[model samples]
Target: MHFELRDYQFLKVKQYLKQKFLLFSNGASQTSTNWLAVEQSLSKSNLKYYKVYNKIALKVLTNSVYNNIKQAIKGTFFFLKLDGNTNLLTKQQLFKKLKSVFFTLLSIKLNNKIYSIVQIKKIKSLNYRSNMSIFYQFLSANLKCVYGITYKKISKQCDLNT
Candidate 1:
């Protein structure tokens, strides 16, 4: 299946216009050959795309970020006892902790090569899309209340403790 940034519901035209470049990945399960088609399509288009020239460096960075987030989530869940007693914290409290951990981890400087958390936040605010399927899936698996409820509603309900 082909993925297009324009197809994402969260991406608006104004936000899309502001982007200097796009980040593309066919996903971990796909081979590098799959990206060749995407690269060729991009070459013919006006938009610029970020390419990972050093696969080793990119893999290391990706893994480091993934592990850091994973650990943060684990620690937060453990400290809050969300794993054992999901109702110990309200939904809002749980979400607040998760968001805090996510952003705090992002704020740390992993290396000179990667973009800063500030930049990432700016892009995210602009509605620039990233592959968050895995991240959301991870959160869903860990936090049962996150699945069905909206954030605004979550704040008003102590669903986690229910």
Candidate 2:
């Protein structure tokens, strides 16, 4: 019965996505592994998605990405001064913003634990062809929505209280 319930949950998520390009994913935190499995399965289907996180979660995420809060602010200021959209600012203002964004994603901290970002060059597959649909889904699904706007929509009826 327990195993059947798990399968049911996975199937429900897949079906939900099949109907709507995006799934609300009320169970995202509990079903992390299900997401990986769904991504693997949906890799064949081309889909675009997005996720929304509140302000508090965003702060925590920032702290996690830059364990040293001081360094994070320094990096932010450095990048803004160098690449900020102002005619007065020039290339020599500070370090290159692009390089910092790329390099700084190496590690993130959560609950005092450091997590390293793994770069997998290639996925082992029976066919030589690459299926990047899963990558897109995963990337979009993790996107943090700003001010309740997940994506451009004609409708704006989301209840933010949840």
Model 2 spans > 4 angstroms off: 1-27, 56-162
Q: Candidate 2's C-alpha lDDT?
A: 0.31
Q: How many residue pairs collide in each prediction?
A: 1, 0
True lDDT of residue 84, candidate 1: 25
TM-score, candidate number 1? 0.19
Compared with the true structure, all predictions reach lDDT values of: 0.34, 0.31
As a TM-score, model 2 comes out at 0.17
Model 1, global lDDT: 0.34
Q: Write one digit per residue (lDDT tens) for candidate 2, span 20-40.
A: 112121112325676565444
